[model samples]
Target: MYRLLIVDDEDIITDGLYEVFNRYQPERLDVCKAYSAKEALDWMSRTRIDIVLTDIAMPGMSGLELSEEIQKYWPRCRVVFLTGHSEFEYAYRAIQMTN
Candidate 1:
């Protein structure tokens, strides 16, 4: 099974994604939710995360920074960023990080 960690400052987004993944792919995915980058890091320290779905414009640590931290510890882990903002710079930076 793949371990998926969904991080978002908004409880609704985090909880919604958690429920959606659990409902749709319970057998294939072990989904976890985090309300902040700090909480996500806490989860990472405890267990191996295969994938992370996070919001980019968080209060403390941005998703881009979190991604860099994740890459340092879990080089193979995949990160997917989600944001309500429609800024071109955010998208550009996200793409740049993937390269």
Candidate 2:
């Protein structure tokens, strides 16, 4: 089973993704949710996360920063960023960092 952590400041996004993943792939994935980058780090400290789906423009630590932190500890972990922002700069920055 893969451990997936979904992080978003918005309760709805986290809850909705949690529901969808659980409903669709309960046997394949163990899904967890965090409302902030801090909470996601807390989860990471306790458990081994295989993948993280996070919002980019969070209040405290942006998803990009969180990704860097994750890479330090879990170098093989995969990060998928989610953002409502349509700005080209956000996409460009994310792509640059991943490369």
Candidate 3:
């Protein structure tokens, strides 16, 4: 099964994504949610995550930093950043991090 982690500081966003993923019933897809980067890190340490969908700007650690962490610890996992137009610079930085 493909494990997906949705990380967003806002409860609504995470909950909404979770519901959408669950409703779609993607082939062997398992969805998890985390409210912060730290929480997501903790979850990743315990679970095998295939994909990480996170917001760019968060409370403590940014999504870019979280992606870097995933690269180091869970190198096989893929990361997708969610950001607003105002955070385009952060999103650009996130894209650069993979390179």
Candidate 4:
């Protein structure tokens, strides 16, 4: 099974995503959620995750920073970031980093 970790500042947002993921049954991925970067890091250190879905603009450590750290530590894990910004710059950077 694919392990998935979700990071978002808002509990409701993560909860909604969890429900959606469950309803969609996205490849039977195991889902876990963290409301803060520190909490996410804690889980990451202890657990093995295949994918991470996170908000780009989060408190303390942003998703970009988290992804970079994950790249250095858990290189095989894939990161999918979400942002409220509709601008091209954020999307461009996200694509660039993921690619």
TM-score of each: 0.97, 0.96, 0.93, 0.88
Off by over 4 Å in 4: 23-27
RMSD of each: 0.6, 0.8, 1.2, 1.8
* Best by the TM-score measure: 1
| Best candidate, lDDT | 1
Per-structure clash totals for the candidates: 0, 0, 0, 0
Off by over 4 Å in 3: none
Per residue, candidate 4 scores C-alpha lDDT tens digits across 4-34 of 8889998899999887776666677788889
> lDDT tens digits, residues 1-99, model 1?
999999999999999999999887688899999999999999999999999999999999999999999989889899999998979899899999999
Superposed Cα RMSD, model 3:
1.2
In lDDT terms, how accurate is model 2?
0.93
What value does the lDDT take at residue 84 in candidate 3? 68
Clashing pairs in 4: none
- Candidate 2, pairs of clashing residues: none
Clashing pairs in 3: none
> Compared with the true structure, what per-residue lDDT tens digits does model 2 show for residues 1-75?
999999999999999999998787788999999999999999999999999999999999999899989989888
lDDT of each: 0.94, 0.93, 0.91, 0.87
lDDT of 1: 0.94
Per residue, candidate 3 scores C-alpha lDDT tens digits across 51-90 of 9999988989989889989999889999998976585678
